[model samples]
Target: MRAHHRSRLLAATAAVCALSVALAGCSGTTKKDSKDDAKEKAQNAKADPDAPLKKGLKIAFLPKQINNPYFTVVDKAGIKGIKEFGGKGKEVGPSDPKASSQVSYINTLTQQRQNAILLAANDPNAVCGPLKQAMKQDVKVVSFDSDAGKDCRHVFVNQAGSDRLARQMVQDLSRQIDDKGEIAILSATQNATNQNTWIKIMKDELKKPRYKDVKLVKTAYGDDDDQKSFQETQGLLKAYPKLKGIISPTTVGGAAAARYVSGSKYKGKVVLGGLGTPNQMRKFVKDGTVKEFLLWDAQHLGYLAAYAGAALASGQITGKQGETFKAGKLGKYKVGKDGEVVLGPPTVFTKKNIDKYDF
Candidate 1:
């Protein structure tokens, strides 16, 4: 009877062991299934619900010129913004701001199936066809610094409203010239949309009663070439000996004009002002050749541009109207009706404020 009881106990213990094993196996399977489902859900959450499979993508940044300090600063900031915002890209531009050169770059990038292109177009219409083609291939395009054909680019990251920047440039110089003087404009290429738009605003602003005394004698194009801009500066001094001031809206043109006036017989005779990098205008500013200049934070411009492009890439914000998105260090920007991101107001670089900026 004791032996029989022992056998029965062994059978009962065996049954309990098998049941426990079965339960543990079922539990393990359930945990693994739950984990996989959670992982898939998290991945799906990361993807664009509106435009599927948009995260961890790549875009391209094409400035007008690669080596230009303006573009270089933008490129650096673009890389930083991309890294911070979870995207990938590289900054490329032509040796010069030629539409043809940029077209080639665009073609190659499009061929690689790049997700998007962030461009500061050298030529307005020249980029239109290529950009359109990219769009057809399901590639997106964003413009910054300089705009291209509006239809071709999904969004434009304007430094400021065209009217605001234009009027500001003219007004900033008017204050220095005391609202009256013969001021010649040393502009970039005549075809440059930004320069032309700013000049028009300046002209309109000049016609206002407050600036009636401010005479615009001549407008010359440097094609953004240093030598040409310098020559134009000399020509302005010669043609208008009564010229009291000069305004250049191009970074290179402004710096070259400053140097020309600083080294010329017109030194201190004519005040120089316009949009230029603080670092480039420092010597001229100290010597009184350039009293002041105006520009937005160039690095921040790139930072904002990259964020704008990445937002479009990820569908965080579409090129649609009234959309707002965060741009890391640049803060949040709201898109306007035309799908453009306007950066903040221009910060005038003067003696007091110039020293505070490193870039």
Candidate 2:
């Protein structure tokens, strides 16, 4: 029965226009319709950077998966930031990170008249229909971590520059394998925007003259599940005994891969690394299963997302390039092209510095 429900859900997500979502069915709301409505709504009131933030604004964060430790730190930090601005916020999400699992929550939040919905979209387009209806009702949409597509959201809070972070991870991994070996990527969900963006950039980067001998053996998805990632790591090594490294950019995937390699016969033979929180990767680093890894502070990422959402809901900004808003303690940040706000550079964690930080 659970499998049947999931199958139907997947079918609906694949054809969101043919089925009803949070605001009902999507019969006439095509991609062109959403874009057209956005253009029609473009005559928005001017943003006021100095406007005082309003009190008691209703905002909620929906991460890809609530069970993931990375998002736990992120969403809790978001709640902390919202309170600082006199707004009320909470974190809510599905235990499973399916593409369509977040749709029901989006509908419920819109019905509750939430002032804003801060989302880490599972799939860029899967959540667009409900998000558009939410916007039509005056609810602001701010995407963080992953995106809800440009037309569907008012702003995207990026942890770091996408291309820069992806390229940096590739370089970080390449050095560990001596820049020439069979390597595979164990990533999050296949449709995840952030993961896809990083994977594409990494693939493009590997084509350069600098990494000609580094053959990418395969790209596998663990769906951000710990056990699945562990198994995927095991499979990669077994399938390619000559594999020298595995790059997992998702926190869960990276940590799971490390755990797998640490206990298996592949320990020192196969290097495991990628975007990992300092605390989670510390043991792996100390045990010599991982040499180094990269990550931005998840707390800072969530904290910034909350302030950005509040700023939009308060009329302080309209997700336009060049507009700036003040994030409490973190200070001012300017929106870049397509409403992208980058947190900052990611830190590379090694055995020497992994113990110095937590979360």
Candidate 3:
């Protein structure tokens, strides 16, 4: 609710509106594909408004991986939301962050007859079959953070607009490096949907004339493990000695990169920026190892996902464009094309404002 947060949200909305217009004018197979997608959505839009959940609805959350701090925080917030709505909530997932690791859990939740399954998919396509089966069983599915395929979920709670977040990353890094230097990206898994999308948009942003002197030297995947991420940061420094900045869009990768840079020889020489929580990046910001980083409220992201799942299960709104629902505390949200719901814009964290936020 800060002024910075409001500006980011406005920027994100403007970016999404611009993208919608651009896509509308495209011709050829892209247009045909859009039409086909719309037809499919129309066919799947029917939901029984009379069939609300009975008492004590059971909801299960399956994050990409368990034991990761970021997912832990977000999942706890989801659980809180579910309980607030008088539903039972549970968290389940794999220890490792792999695309196929969540299949068994999805099957189990489906068999258990959960009212809804809130997921953060590791890969876009790997879990679609199991999720589709869950759908067949009348279990509503909503994805958050990282989404599965569109057909596999009822809704996706996007943390921020893809183009806006990507542009913010580039802008922050460029400011730190004086708009001219070699930079590298430390991403999560190679197949992560959100990470790949942001990376692609970042590549596009770098093509602008203002960034002509900026060179993307390399992109390395850390697999979302703290140790692996730390090692990857080390490898990037060694591989690109002239690297002036690093952008890591995963919380685990961002924190790991900050830790590595804060302790290593590149402490004050190389700048680090990306998506990280206030708790994880506070020390680095205070120490001057990381001057700026960005993240939305993960708690609110989870809370919104839970409410979206509840709305889908209760048939309050079908996953159609312009369908609106009220999420507790956050007010109303409208579903856009592809059943995507933007949580809000990201917040820029710095030493001056970092202490005001807890999550």
- Pick the TM-score winner: 2
> Which lDDT tens digits does candidate 1 get at residues 205-324?
888999888899999988787888899988889999899888888898999999898888988778777789988888888888887888999889888888777776676765766777
Whichever of 2 and 3 has more lDDT, that candidate is 2
- In the order shown, the candidates' Cα RMSDs to the true structure are 20.3, 9.8, 15.3
- The sequence of per-residue lDDT tens digits that candidate 2 reaches over residues 1-359 is 99999999988776875554455546555344554475246336589998999999999999998899999999999999999888999888899999999999999999999998999999877899988888888888999989888888989999999999999988988888889899999999999999999999999999999899899999999999999999998898889999999999899999999999999898898877779888788899999999999889899999999999889889899888899999999999999998899999998899898888888
- Stretches off by above 4 angstroms in model 3 are 1-54
Give the per-residue lDDT of model 3 (tens digit) for 1-359: 69999999989987876777666642232444432343255346776544554448899999989898888889999899989889999999999989899999999999999999999999877888888878877788899998887888888999999889999999999999999999999999998999999999999999999999999999999999999999999999999999999999999999999999988899999999989999999999999999999999999998999888888878776788778888878998999989899998999999999999987
How many pairs in model 2 have backbone atoms within 3 A of each other, for residues 3 or more apart or on separate chains, i.e. clashes? 1
Clashes of each: 0, 1, 0
Candidates ranked by TM-score: 2, 3, 1
Model 2, poorest ten-residue lDDT window? 30-39
Worst 10 residues of 1 by lDDT: 34-43
Model 3 / residue 296 / CA error / Å: 0.2
Q: How far does residue 168 in candidate 1 sit from its true spot (Å)?
A: 1.5
Alpha carbon lDDT of each predicted model: 0.79, 0.89, 0.89
